[model samples]
Target: MTIQNSHNTLPLDPAQPERQARDEGQGPMPPQAPTPTQPLAQPTPQAQVVPQPIAYQPQPAAAPSNGVALTAMILGIVGAVAGFWAVVPITGYFSAAFGFPLAVAAVICGHIGRARSKRVGGVGRIQALVGFLLGYVSIAVMVIASAAWTVFLFIGSL
Candidate 1:
């Protein structure tokens, strides 16, 4: 048997002249040259290389966006301001008409924002809650003012 080390090949048994001759770039010695006491070298089996499959690693999901919460907050603020202005005598009628729709839209956006925030580990949760409250408050104020105006008109007509 022979061991291959880098570019050099070494024989397991140094006493074998045929292995030494073969390792040193010389062809194997003649069959008659081999002595009876020394055994001949058997051919070594070649090793086959097998490729391994790569492991699969799961990636983390991306964080949710805060834009919805910000939009909800802005819409709620505008709707609330409109609702307050809806109490005016003349312009109130127009404000009431516009404010109610804005408040409803604010409420819808706030609900979506809050749900998204919850999924994103509480990011923008406070803004979503604030918008939700403001939307409800605006709706309530507009409703009350509109009902009072209607009642006053009804009584005046009677």
Candidate 2:
């Protein structure tokens, strides 16, 4: 077969007669006629959607107590004040005696404070312990000095 070429058109391949026919404004080839051959297949089944229920959970909250902290602070202050008084000269002995009780109270208050603070949150454990220690030490020294004074007086009288 021979290829035809126009002045403004490119040459077409003779081997592609079907393409050349369509390019020349010919309609596309008619669809092939169907034949009664086999039976049609059926569609497959789809899955069903279902909703799920969620379980509810309760949470426990933290409970804080401020009383212990307040008591601790007050006791610590009292211990410090008493301990300070005990450090003086004549009044020192009486102060130390008074400070002993205050120190004991401070220690108890400090323990309570630490427990409450752990539950709530506060500061002053160091101060409470120090006050308690100082008060107790002063009380011990006072007792020893008093005993020594008594013994000395008795010996001097003899």
- Candidate closest to the true structure, highest lDDT: 1
What digit string (tens of lDDT, one per residue) describes model 2 on residues 67-92? 65566556656665765665455676
Error of 2 at 58 (Å): 20
Model 2 regions lying over 4 Å from their true place: 1-63, 121-158
Best by TM-score: 1
Clashes of each: 0, 0
Q: What are the TM-scores, per candidate, against the unseen true structure?
A: 0.58, 0.39
Please provide, for model 1 over 1-158, each residue's C-alpha lDDT reduced to its tens digit, 9 standing for 90 to 100. 77888898766774566767787989887665456687877878888888999899889878667778888888889899999887886677788788888888888888999999988888888888888788999999988888888888889999
